[model samples]
Target: MATFLFDKIIFGPVKSRRLGVSLGINLLPNDCKLCSFNCIYCECGWNPDQYDQKINFHPKAQVKESLFEKLSQMKANNEDLDVITFAGNGEPTLHPEFSEIIDYTIQVRNKVFPQARIAVLSNSSMIHKKSIFKALNKIDDNILKLDGGTEETIINLNQPVGKFNLDNMVKLLSKFDSNLIIQTLFIRGEYEGKIIDNTTNAELEAWISHLQKIKPKEVMIYTISRDTPSDNLEKISMNELEQIAKRVDAAGFKTQISS
Candidate 1:
């Protein structure tokens, strides 16, 4: 189960299944993964030993300069840019100057590519912080993760590094109401002798119930499309994803699937 990391602060304008041509921004360190959740399915691989690791986040000024330079070049060449996304090595919200960076990114995006939207692909672990939550709301696409309905499934799947409360997280998500887009990665497999599956009937029931409470603008349902850190994981099929999407649609939320 080999995985990789984004080696640059400002990386691709890669074709995304869910989003159009997206120019990515990596706020975390370039050398290693730094995140609150050490997800088994993370493409950037597992979190490193932080105790002995010298963690250094990309500075806000550097990020702004790199982004402006890239966007300026892309705009000059008339490159198709749909979104300026905050997604890379790890969780972008984990950066200390995340809010200020967002403000700068917004300014740059408006100046260079007004048509392009700003989006953040967050795991929803840091939304409890007022600054992070406010910054997320300011973006065009405030996508957040809600992988599991139950606390047990979330803990087993996400493996948050610190304290986690499913009830409180869902409640906080509800604050965004229609402004938020809930993203859920559905998978079934065994990890550390435990069977992990969020596609089960009971699992979907609980997940949909949470969606009903949150009332998000849209729901992004996806499965593993790349090599994961864990070898035993199984990717859910498109048909299965559609079935799950139907459940979400039935619950009265817009659904987007990327298989």
Candidate 2:
């Protein structure tokens, strides 16, 4: 329903509560969507009917060109670039040329707005790939998603592919040399006839302990910020999210709450 979502490959300068005004670059196809995880809180909706949005999305070359033109215009306009982000409707890493795209983006953006930071909001699905890590290393803010700590909770919340291994996933992310920044959304609700709740003390404790091993530089925890695809999703109260933030902060890491 969102027709004029983005112009060319770049979209926004959109208002981001956490990242400030972000210049968005969607690498996936505009017509069809693709993603590794079918998250309950995805604002752009689910992946293809079967986890593959088989759209006739443009090739990587076209996407890069779109970004170049839009960025050039922004430079000429003397616009502000808070964060140059790679986030489209679906999993940005799905783009075949993900590594090259990140490299070129950094090159061009540096020439124009040297102070602007590059940020990638990833689901952490393909982080195990060597190539993916190579690109992520160049980012200023490596904000990765780890919605649920335990494998069960992760599968329930993220609803990734059947074989998606949370243990393996977390291990891969923990290897990043940078101080990984994690963003988590706590919620409790129902979908279809099933109830989905992650507010129990057991769940939170599991999440906290799991994070200790990863030892991220900072953590961002908050309630849902947008409409999720699932109807049974509910945003955790600000009070609850704050309490979680306190626990995380106590663990010797910086934590910020959106609400």
Candidate 3:
């Protein structure tokens, strides 16, 4: 079984393939994966056992304090930073104090590294909520995930919890009006006797349609860069990613390949 990647609230001024040097803020519990989607490719592993691993969501005050401490230390040492990203064990918008945290993060970031961009890596599950949407609008990089277009592909790949459907997701995302960035992860292989591949002509065509509807500022297409929970999955190569990106670029939408 795969385990959680981060064990702390504030972690890593780590090098990112897409975002440059990033400081990660983990709002979910440090011990378990708390997510709305039980994705097959999740590095934090399967979610069936997550309920048992649930710990209290860290308080907003503590998160701010910890983040401030880390940022202060980094500033003291004159560490370079490009982005302060909210990405960790699982979905970040699920944090009850998400809006407040975003506000505080902006304040702290302005004081420490005024030039650093504040980004959120969201699954778009909570974008339907007015508070979440409003808060996301305040950030520099509001990157949301759109792994599949069809409901079958979504269920097979992302396995979203609760009442989530593609049409509603499209509606919510379109509300962002090109202010947001669309992120898609392409992968191939099998899981539980079924073949899984999002790089197919049918999937790509459907995804492109959705991208056109959203009209995002940019589209980030990427593949698994680390060990996923499932052994049956395989990463799509850079060449394949570029081929797909070419199609997206031709569609008049800005695209970035993060393979």
Best by TM-score: 1
lDDT of 2 at 155: 78
* Residues 1-259 of candidate 1: C-alpha lDDT, one tens digit per residue: 8899898998888998999999999998888888899998999999986534456898888998899999999999999999989989888998999999999989888888999999999999899899999999999999999999899999999999999999999899999967999999999998899999998999999999999899999999999999999999999999999999998999898999999
Q: Model 2: C-alpha RMSD to truth?
A: 2.4
- Angstrom error at residue 113, model 1: 0.5
Over the stretch 212-233, how does candidate 2's per-residue lDDT look in tens digits?
7777888888777676677767
Per-model TM-score on C-alpha atoms? 0.98, 0.91, 0.96
Off by over 4 Å in 2: 1-8, 50-55
**Could you tell me the C-alpha RMSD of candidate 1 in Å?**
0.9
Error of 1 at 150 (Å): 0.8
lDDT minimum window of 10 residues, candidate 1: 47-56
Give lDDT: candidate 3, residue 254.
90
